[model samples]
Target: MSIEAGKPAGLRERKKLETRIALGWAAIRLTVERGFDAVRVEDIAAEAGVSPRTFNNYFSSKAEAVAARHLDRARMIAEELRARPASEPLWEAVANAVMARFGLTQETRGAGTSDQQWITGLRLMMTEPALQGEFMKAGALAEFELAAAVAERTGTDVERDLYPRLVAGAVWAAITVVTDHWLHADPPVAIVPLLRDALHQLAAGLPVP
Candidate 1:
């Protein structure tokens, strides 16, 4: 197909992604404001400026909507990792890929640096009982994507090799633990430094202090 022919398809895909992201953010905001149990799919759709039927086309449940943001970000990370310089070490590439867009913005980063209300909302959303299972599913999806990227980068078979999956798991764990610490730190800390340190330690074999 020619460039002109592909333009409409690209635009359509972008619009769908934007809609999905809007719905997910709406779900998170509503859940934070009214508690997870009180929020409904219709409310999320309305908040996102879409209809309930449209929301249903994107996500089966409110929890899935909320988790979609994480899944999307993870996929982006995998893509970024794939694009990093070939000369860079795998850990460095992975870290840079993650730090490239993962929560660098004021709207999504942290309570201390960004909007407090949104951070508080995110904290509430993370702890919701109904959302836990969805988050796990999101994590699994994220890990799978990362593993595939790692396998490609290292020229390993993702299906048969253990290295890619292990690296992916470690990276995911670092992301999870560091983000949790940043979220709950007594004196709030910047997420970027914490994430960088976590990756550094992992790359350095977690040497004794």
Candidate 2:
């Protein structure tokens, strides 16, 4: 795993994480400032204060770099799920794991970057062709890791069993819905409550009203 739960990152790992984050933020910022087609990988690297070689080592394309945080956060959620108490119910564990990483409270909102920046970057992804593809790819990778973690917790086969995949898909769908709603919300409602409600509805089997 790139980052371990409950453990401090080593200096080397910390440096790598910093570099990845810098390149990612640079990619998004540049893409936002210029049109996506106008922002080259070289420009992203330059903005991040790294060479093109260093940028290539971390990401294959500018789109991937811009979408890196989504992948990273999903991985963190999987790790958080694995670290949850074994005795907890699966849905509860899943919800807690998601919130641990994605809850948009004051502390979490200010960590590393501002909430407005994240929201703007995500809205941009919806319209950018290359970035939309990369965002979907990132989502698929996140679903795969999340399914594996759920499978591990439930002693199910990630490839053969439907349960883990279903759970992962549901979680990902919920995230997508919440983010989309939050992005286009006429008045801009908070996301955490929506996330919690969505997960709760899923946990409750989505009964008819």
Candidate 3:
């Protein structure tokens, strides 16, 4: 779909979104079943019903496919922030948007056997060297996107100075802290509250509690 100035997206964009979702799910399922290291790019492409070339068009590597979920979350938050009321404070808008986008639902909280597998995969991602590198790259891309959004919202000059970068770095740092905590938390508490709390602390210019 075309995203012209001040215009809504079109059918093409919606179709592209569907394709991306299919590929993302296919990749996640494969990784969960066979473990990340065991999954091959050709197998993932076949599973997603796409050519290896098409898979490469969507993602650079198999690790990227598995990390797509997290990248999508950041993209969702950026989109939400961009759509928020113009008059709202930037930090409040960003925090609220992040929570709305990533907040867990009842099903996710009560996820049974699948939850264990999902958590295991996430733990593997955190500890595996290859996955960690992929994760960092995805995170850096997300930070740049987020910084652009914040610059637009706050009327800060993104290219000319360090303010925008500083804002982006602080936001990303807060998110990293929350993610690290969530990874280690035994009972798998909801991340929304942790993220919101962290953002709130940042907004207040105080240490995270």
Q: Highest TM-score: which candidate? A: 1
Candidate 3, 47-78: lDDT as tens digits: 76788888888888887877776677677777
Cα-based RMSD of candidate 1: 4.2
Question: Which is the leading candidate under lDDT?
Answer: 2
Cα lDDT, model 1, residue 106: 44
Candidate 3 residue runs with Cα over 4 Å from true position = 1-6, 46-49, 103-113
State the lDDT at 113 in candidate 3. 33
lDDT of each: 0.83, 0.86, 0.75
TM-score of 2: 0.85
With candidate 2 superimposed using the best TM-score fit, by how many Å does residue 34's alpha carbon deviate from the native?
A: 3.7
The candidates, ranked best first by lDDT, are 2, 1, 3
Q: Write the per-residue lDDT of candidate 2 for residues 1-209, one digit (tens) a residue.
A: 36865688999999998898788778876776566888999998998899999999999888899888788889989999999999999999999999989944434233555667667755775798888899999999999999999999999999999999999999999999998999888776889899999999999998897
Judged by whole-model lDDT over C-alpha atoms, candidate 2 comes out at: 0.86
Global local distance difference test of model 3: 0.75
